[model samples]
Target chain A: MIDHMSALFTLGNMQFLLRGAGMTLLLTMIGCTAGLFGGFLLAYARGSKGTLTAPLRWGATAFVEIFRRIPFLVTLFLVLYTAQMIVPRAPLFWVAVVSICLLCSAYMAEIVRSGMESVPAPQIEAAEVMNFSRWRITWMIVLPQAWKVILPSAVSYMVMFVKDTALASQAGVFELMFAGKALANRGLDPFLVFATVLFAYFVISWPLARFGRWLEAQLARRTHEGDRR
Target chain B: MAHLDISGLEVRYGTVPVLSGIDLAVERGELVGLVGPSGSGKSTLLRALVGLVPPAAGRVVLEGKDVDYASKASLRGLRDHAAIVFQQYNLFQNMSVLDNITVTPVKVRGRPKAEAEAEARALLARVGLAGKERAYPDQLSGGQQQRVAIARALALKPALILLDEVTAALDPELVRDVLDVIKDLAGEGITMLLVSHEMGFIREAAHRVVMMDAGRVVEVGPPSQIFDAPTEERTRAFMSKIIRH
Candidate 1:
């Protein structure tokens, strides 16, 4: 066991895995951050009413539906092939980023839309009586009230997304799983290398789960405090 | 001219007529009570006045001016002069009592924050929710929230107030608190069209009562006539079925 551990836990090997973990972290941070912004725009477009925005609502719905139904590996390859055609020689990292963004935005839009729906209709009508602009009502009243409903689910989606980013390795992007594959191919025992990879994934994802629970508690407490009656 | 005049107003929800060919008018400072059974279009009439429900065909003359619902400016002008209090209170759950009252004045009307806040305090006092400026809507009783709704409407200083079943949702004991505030507002000579089920209060407080059913106004008269000597057979049936103790 000691000899097996020594072979697996060399300083050079540790550095290789740590760097891969760092890359995975960056990919998740960028993809999720960008996805969140795009998802908000998509959801607002989806929620838009009236004839003027009918096309936008339809398009947003289509985009979310299409990307959500597509498998992640297929999306990566699709982005890869599309990027090759649109801008050949683009870095594989960007291809992976684009694919992650597409997948995350589709999922995030659903999470946001459900959150927005949880706010009662009366809250919106009252704003209308006050002659508040639709934008003002959404930003000032709807989103604020919706946060209590949205936070826990949003955090959980993001945690799930962190795991989803692992799929990027299939596209030749350097991330955690890709590093483990490379070490196993380099004559290290497959079980030990993969076990270390699993531990690394746990190390990253466990804090996210804890943070989501903590945030959910905080939001629940705020709602309770406001609703004493 | 009457303060608000409706002639041949029509509203439909996708081929189902909810209110049709409705005609009613209220003079300035008149406290008009609109009492009717469920689905009688009492609430829809008020919602139509504020442009919440689209009017398919009608003429609404307000403050001696014809209101064109197709025109956004005209609709906004109508809201500026008239406000509706919903049965559900419809307070902004995210905001405190004070912000609920002051948001429109300060944010939309461009009134100074300090001035709007000061007037909101005064309105809160008038509604008997003086110290609740910091409380959220969920933290208050239904009666208190309804009072806050009233204060929110009054904050706009509207010339016409539409009360759509304002007291319908309150607890029996809590009904008096909201009704008392409406009574005080009526005594102050504010023009109002209140839709309520409290027949006894309407008889005592209304300058005129309008009886409606099945998308039409069955009768319009003094409260004594509508309640005691109702001219319409529908009104008599409705009056007898209220189950008043």
Candidate 2:
């Protein structure tokens, strides 16, 4: 066991593992950043009132709910086939990216939505009587206050997406897990390969979790201390 | 003609009536004090005026113009001329004191930011919160926040100001600070409808007091008459209960 583990820690193996880790990091970065923006749009569309936005509300609601219920692995294949059908020759990486975006946006929208709704009704009423347009009220009063609630959850979600992107490996998108599997198929000990994969995941996710906690602390202080600007 | 008149104002949440047929009027620059037991719809009345509650039925004539609640333009026109100060002083938590007072004026009213900000500072001074513009709402005491809210309402230059228990949420020691600001505004000849539980403050500041019970006005008279010599049994009974506390 010692000889096998010792052989697994090669410079070439480390480089290969790092490359796979880089792909996982890329998916998380693209998914979280793009998903955050898409999530807000979804949340806003869902939360909008008035008869005219009724259809938009329904469409956004259905998208968040339906996409959230489907498993990530299933979505990877679903998007894999669907994207291939649409573009006929779309790259697997782009197809994987689309699946991660869809999965992350649905979950992130709910995080953002609950944050938006967390504002007391009276706060919105205060704006209403001030003659603020609903859009202005949302942007100025609601969103600024909502960031405190949204940030911690959003960062944690990014950490979660780090692991979630491993699901992309099933579709041959090349990430940490896929590298581990390939190394194992090449006759390396499976335990050692997966152990490296798990360590790489921890390296990527630990900082994000710590950052989330730090952000939560800052928000609490800002809220209580009334930090200027 | 009165500067503001609300006749047959009706508000309901589905089948439950919050305010039914509330008829009241205030002369130009007159302060009308609204006193009532809990759940008597005093706040609801204030909410309805600014188009928050959407009165189920009513004719609200303001400054000789009729307000049609069903018409967006009309409701907007009404809000353009009226503002409300809440008991909890619901200042936008994210904004500095100056921004809270100036946001509507600068953004919604399309006034120049510098001009509106200057006016906000002046209003803040009038409310006795000078040199606190950079502070956020959580930094202020209840009385200070409520005064900030009053300043925010005053920034609108509204023809009518509805103060719904503006001091109700204040610490007892802080109540006098907000009351002092309100008394000064009343002296400036601004029309106001004030809902409060502080009978002593209302009696001293209000031009006339209107007592509400069960979503209806039970009595209307000067403070002396309402507090010392109420005619209706309901007003007398409610006042006795409130004053004892």
Chain B global fold similarity (TM-score) for predicted model 1 against the true chain B: 0.97
Cand. 2: chain B TM-score: 0.97
Q: What's the CA error at residue B31 for candidate 1, in Å?
A: 1.8
Where model 1 places Cα greater than 4 Å from the true spot, the runs are: A224-229
CAPRI level of candidate 1: medium
Instruction: Give all candidates' CA lDDT scores.
Output: 0.88, 0.88
- Across residues A84-131, which tens digit of lDDT does each residue of candidate 1 receive? 998989799999989988988888888888888888787787788778
Q: List the residue pairs that clash in candidate 1.
A: none
Q: What does candidate 2's lDDT look like per residue over A18-92, in tens digits?
A: 999999999999898888888999999998887899999999999999899989998889999998888998898
List the candidates' TM-scores in order.
0.95, 0.94
